[model samples]
Target: MAKKRNQVRRCVKKYIPYELHPDDFLQTMTKIFCYSRWFGVAGSGNLVWKIFGILILLLLAIIEGVAIWRVIKALAGWAVDIIGHRSVTARLAGTMFYASSIVTLILSWKLSSSWDELAAFWASVDQTMAINVPPDKNLKNRMISVTFIIMACVILEHTMCMMSQIGFDCPASLILKRYTLMSHGFLLLRTDYSIWFAIPLLFLSKVATILWNYQDTLIVTVSMGLTSRYYRLNNFVAKFSVAVKKDLSRNKQSNSLNSRNEYTWRKIREAYVKQAMLVRRVDAWLGGLILLSSLVNFYFICLQLFLGITQGLSGSFIKRLYYLVSLVWLCVRVSCVVLAAADINVQSKRALRYLYACDAHCYNIEVERLQNQLSKEYIALTGMGFFSLNRSILLKVRKDMAGAVITYELVLIQFDDNGTTAHIPSQSNATF
Candidate 1:
């Protein structure tokens, strides 16, 4: 039996490309997502696992719903007290945080629902590129490294935020109390909640945090994978261009060789088409996620900057440290997500450079077709058809954020100059 098994393994290895195996491609990410219950493994026939995944998702949904409800209730209370309280910043930040959490949870549910289509997309991408482009030798290591970095950053940020809230000077009992309240999303509720309730909410909050960070990590990882494929394709074209130049210079070009070059170009073109289609599929799957992530990141960044400028070294040491670390971390993470997605568009267009440089002898109908396809197609991820993710977006977002911060600062300065505070009007104060 062992001999027969070995023989079968050898036969399969000999005939099938390693990249064709869906399990091997993005294996680390697949494992992480599956373990988190955000996605199920493709082709799995385990009934119990599927049921368990469903239950886990349902539980998370219920928890998130409760958390959101609590946030809304807190917002209503704040609205009533807005005239007397100057805690606008805290309220806004908390609201944005919970709103972003809700968005991340929804994206997670979407991913779980579309796992089969996602699996098929991966399979198609692998089959398209496996024939000519060799797999990246360090892909697994790279993925693992990315996962590690994302996890470390998230864990550090969460810990620091929690500690900042609890304060370093507090006694153990007080610290524990504060931690429970914060984790249970009851800090803003201003009411005592049961320990039993807090414990479960704490666990659910941790899970929610994981899902939030994992969503961005997943986007970055998948973007890296797609960008690498396009890069490989571009490299192949470059090398082939070099060979074509050499043949033309040596006067060794012949009819058969020209035909072969054309055939290669045709194959590359077909692969390019497949890649573009795969990107569209990916965009469809992740567009809502990207849109929500961008909005949430933008809002928080603006809010953080506003708070940092207005507060400015006035808070506790731990609070100051948390603010600085979180701002830097958020900027780095957001930049990574944006640039990673943008590179897909950049890499897709890069092939055009090589195609244009092809030797005259090698240029043919296939070459022209490929050039046209590359030039005409605006292949990039989008925010649910609202906006394209590209280099320009980064610049635009930065500009807008700066403008927003400046405008907010001006408003505060005007309020201070008038010697009166800006406050939300109470119901009794309404004129109409």
Candidate 2:
């Protein structure tokens, strides 16, 4: 008993140093297992790993199901047409969205199955722990390398697709592009975060599978490779950004700051200033909704990272909330694109109240003819261009602007009529 206790003490001393916090050992032993938190996911030693593997399968299935459901819901809606009214762009966007969703679902299913199989294999290996075993270092190394290569290639391909679809050349395009890229990037980042968590869990599971697997060398190598890849990618992105910034700075430096800058720059600056003010208004109105989402995502990322290291499952609620927020945003953006497309034939009517008898008669005749010809002419002018997916997205933005305008108008009306309370639209519910 004394020797056994000494061995345990030595083992704890040897193993516990890798923990970020000294208390992580205690936390790991006592804190709820994430798998166990979901009933039936934990069982006897072998079965636990098996069940854990199955849980992973279930998770992937759920994600795929949710993705499919979202795509189907996106397709089933009149919102797409009604909101993007008369837009060919909106229709194209609808098609693109459906295609993207299908592709993602398929990719996710394939990846999930691979992961499940790996987990099951490890679980099976663990079930026979009493038998003599060999290291099989070459096989293990190859497996790890293949797993990483597959993940890296898939991730790179997805990132390139995102860059092609969403990345733009200029500042104006960057606004929409940035959001699109970030949204998709966030999805990838979220997946990576899951991978980070799973790695440690798989390491522990492997330990339970065999004494040889408990050797830290393999885990360290795998982790180092992944970390190196991530760091290299991040550095590359940073350098690209630096290059762009340098070019912009050089361009600005080349131009005279005072003379041409004032004339050309002032006019352009004024236009942008006005636009900035309008954008600020929109952003201000959206602050509560989007800010909440950003905050939740921030929390999830931090908490998940912490949990991944500590073998704890804190902040899952926040993660789910973040996902829910993402879902909502996705729906809103899609709906907006559709609405904008459907609005292609929309126009304004004006009433002129001027006294000129002959001019009035000519105007009346021309106006009548114009009104009669308006639909065909307007339809021809807008065509599929107005129906374009981007335009549909723009129209959704216009709807938001319209709502803001309506809110301001209502406030003014209330102020004028009552000299009391002024109304503002609830920012929480406002959508673009």
Candidate 3:
């Protein structure tokens, strides 16, 4: 089984996109979107010259579109590698990750098609039964419409991009390196990677849970979504290790006793500070998104609980059960991510243990200074830097979960006593 796994891994590796020049795509976007391409005449020319420039720019835009397709194809290959289908579970996971998204887009589409029926139902239902209805009956329709429209645009554009990259024959490292360059080494505050990498993961996790099912789909999707966060952290650590090793080697070669080289030691010290700051920047980049997911998950868990209670209080026995099961499953799904995220934080801090345990004989003045800079002893992954994601969060969540359940139970009891459980009257009359 191990041999087979390795064989599959090898085969998969053989197919990854090679020789990625992501800058080309960036440049293409710049050209297409930049207004300078259409106006701002440099060389003296007649009115015909302006028209000629416009025509030429349009031609280039068409040509760049073709190249953009290739970039997309290359990216598709990269995404495939990231999905990592070397085992049965992995294959199923990749399939479900994508299939679920497709299914959600479809479900939204189907709901959109039945808008007329929904409209009629809303019209027939009086304001008394409209407890959940928006002030505008069309609000739900608009939300679904807008959501799917955006989804369609993204999906279409990405599809073209992916199709263009299929068998694109680009080197993955080159693509990433160029992406790093284009992104100014991730310091430019650009959001290309976040859009291309993070957004899809976010969308996938949400969509997978869109239409609840009693199966492993939720587990698979949450895991896949968190993979991006894990990958980013792992990538940073790898890069950080390489950086530290290089710094250590340089420190070891330096003469600590030489007063003349004191400035060099200062520069090395500065580099250590920069690296530490960069680690925080890495956190800032994706930390908010992960935190957002955590918050959303927590919100929904409470929501599911409240929904279960309210439905039960209102005599929706089956709905209450449905939500009860949903609440449990949602908690389970969230626990998986919280625990995984907590583990990530723990491992991230543990990366420093090796340095702490390193032989002190190898230390120089600069190295010692660098060590002091990192002397906090541990740095864990955080959610928006607001709080650390560790076993502590799990405990806090447990506490909060109990509070939320209690709060909802109290509210449900109050509503039941007040006879507000039937908050909305059922609509049986038809006027629409």
lDDT value, candidate 3, whole model: 0.37
For model 1, what is the alpha-carbon lDDT of residue 170? 77
In model 3, residue pairs whose N, Cα or C atoms come closer than 3 Å (at least 3 residues apart or on different chains), thus clashing, are 18-170, 18-171, 19-170, 19-171, 20-175, 72-161, 73-165, 74-165
Which portions of model 3 miss their true places by more than 4 Å? 1-292, 306-325, 377-385, 416-432
Can you give the TM-score per candidate against the true fold? 0.80, 0.20, 0.35
Tens-digit lDDT string for candidate 1 (111-136): 75576678677776667552356667
Q: Report model 3's TM-score to 2 decimal places.
A: 0.35
Candidate number with greatest lDDT? 1
lDDT of 3 by residue, 119-238 (tens): 343233222121111122332343334334434533443333232222235476445333322212111122334545433333322333332221122222222223323333334334
Q: Is candidate 1 or candidate 3 better by TM-score?
A: 1
For residue 111, model 2's alpha carbon misses the true position, in angstroms, by 14
lDDT of 2 by residue, 1-432 (tens): 676545544433321223221222112212222223232223222555556545554544444353344335434552232121112222222223323222332322232234334334333322322211222324334445543553453344333333333334447634443433233221222224344433433332222212111111122222232222223222332342343345445564433322222232222223222322332332232223222322222232222222223323223454334333433543443343233322322211111111121122123343333334332332211211322222344455546544554454453333222212110010011111
**Clash totals, every prediction:** 0, 24, 8
Backbone clashes in model 1: 0
| Candidate 2, run of 10 with poorest lDDT | 422-431
